[model samples]
Target: MDKTPLTDPALAQLFTQARTYNSWSDRPVDDATVRQLYALVSAGPTTANSHPGRFVFIRSAAARARLRPHLSAGNVEKTMAAPCCVIVAYDTRFHEFMPQLFPSRDFSATFAGKDAVIADTAMRSSTLAGAYLILAARALGLDAGPMSGFDKDTLEAEFFPDGRWKANFLCNIGYGTDDQLFPRNPRLAFEQACLDL
Candidate 1:
């Protein structure tokens, strides 16, 4: 039997050093890489495994143009310069897939006609998936910058006019530049941040 090397202190640093990168090198992130990241992220857990998140990767100048007007001033330069910017969205009608996804029972009917509940569930689940995308990207040796500074209404209208997809967040992915990093910030110790019941 082939045994894999056990995870240890050095492996922990790989996760610890993963930070939100704001600047990227001129290198490009190809479509294949983006698809691979999605394939990895989709396997992460969600409530009932609903898998509501949908990603729209904008790599061309034209698609990036549609995003510019909605971006916050601070996010414009870095986001535009990145090789690919992913629009993480949630499907409002995701419950329709519950029968195929969850399988035990048909749960679609519970949310089919309830707009508020549907929106709430979809947004929460998709946000969790988006976080998974960031972590998966890091594990794959890619730098990620996840931001929430865009205008959601304008983004939805411009990118998903049919009302099926609602914008959640944006993530810029590529090779990062050392010149763009700020000094590492301090983190709370376990005793200060967590409490045992």
Candidate 2:
């Protein structure tokens, strides 16, 4: 496959210029946009195409109310104010769809009986998918605030009482406001953070 580099503006939208918004505008996110965001996220690669990520978009007042108590004190106001809060979760039984996802052959048996591998792969793939969700939303002209400041155990119990899915992280998405933005933080240089073997 031949591909050209994306335009500078596109790159900026997806990375450098994109901010983690802590405040959102009053603009509402419609269901169609949410669905489109997931369509893009689902196309991202995952381990053996396990594709474990499951998303729950909390947009309605009732849903937000249900989510409130699970948030950390610092995350509550921002999350509640955002137009949508997504629960990025992983399906524990994702391997069962290996025949469909991988297609060439069934890889279900490789993970089904292995608890550790299942948990590790599910978490890894779901985290990757969650990252895709962020980038996808940005590409679609939306802002995202990825967060981890929530009570995982209780949140999972509240959202996934069936035990089939487990929460990995949370992300609030919508039209963002600069109302709560702080200065951009610095990142480690390659020499400081990576090894060139």
Q: In terms of lDDT, which candidate is strongest?
A: 2
For candidate 1, write residues 91-153 as lDDT tens digits.
Answer: 988888898898988786678789888888899999999998887777777888999999999
Each model's lDDT = 0.88, 0.95
lDDT of 2 by residue, 160-179 (tens): 99999999999999999999
Which residue pairs collide, candidate 1? none
Evaluated at residue 7, the lDDT of candidate 1 is 74
Clashes (candidate 1) = 0
